[model samples]
Target: MNTQTLEKLREKLHDNANILGNLLVETFHYIGLFAIGAVTAWAGALTCWEMLHQGTITVDDILLLFIYLELGAMVGIYFKTNHMPVRFLIYVGITALTRYLISDVSHHHRPDMGAVYISAAILLLALAVLVVRYASSRFPSSNTPQGANATDDPERAEP
Candidate 1:
């Protein structure tokens, strides 16, 4: 075959392979996100069921549900925008720490360094969330046009 013809055939094959690879990757990515969301919901439901079976809801149980909520929200955001919001993870951390601190204090009935440490961790996570929000607002991503806020773009608006 002529050199030009051979080059064209090679380019066509590469393009087709790239397209197939992208499709497969995207398909799996979506499937994985859906699975994560489903598992989070299932876990939350089981927690509720256990609470109901006990005929009482504790603060810890509620806090755990909130963590599941944040996880589901994070998964949903990632699925929709292909972007993970770091703030949600931080929120989860804060909630989990608060829950632990509460549980610890309630069980121990005494002030301890462990509670102090957990409180400090929660504060740090809260500060991290604030920093992230400030940075996001102050230095909007390149994907967003200048002077245009995320709210201006419905698709990019925070949930």
Candidate 2:
């Protein structure tokens, strides 16, 4: 075969390889996401069952459920948009920290500095969420689609 024909064939092969690689990656990506969603749902269901068996709902249990809810929402949003919401993770962190703080205070007869530290951490996470929201709204990312959330795109996410 002539040099031009061989070059053309090589280019076509390269293009096809790239397409196949992208398809493979996308397939695995979706499968992993579905697995995560399933696990979250299963865990949440088990937690609910345990709560029902106990016959009493505690504050900690409610907070745990909220954490699970946030995780499920995060997973669903990521599955739908192909982007993770940073705010949901922050909300989870805040909820988890609040739960810990409450549990510690109730368990311990005397309050300690650890509780204060956890409160501070929750405040920081809340501030982070606010900052992210403000930045996304004030300066929409160029790579983000029109009318879409800028924060949803990792490229537009704050460092």
Tens-digit lDDT string for candidate 1 (11-109): 999999999999999999989998998999999999999999999999999999999998998887787667777888888899989989999888889
lDDT of each prediction vs. the true structure?
0.85, 0.84
TM-score of each candidate structure, all chains considered together: 0.90, 0.88
How displaced is residue 68 in candidate 1, in Å?
0.9
Q: In model 2, which residue pairs have backbone atoms overlapping below 3 Å?
A: none
Clash pairs (backbone) in predicted model 1: none
Measured by TM-score, the strongest candidate is 1
Off by over 4 Å in 2: 147-159
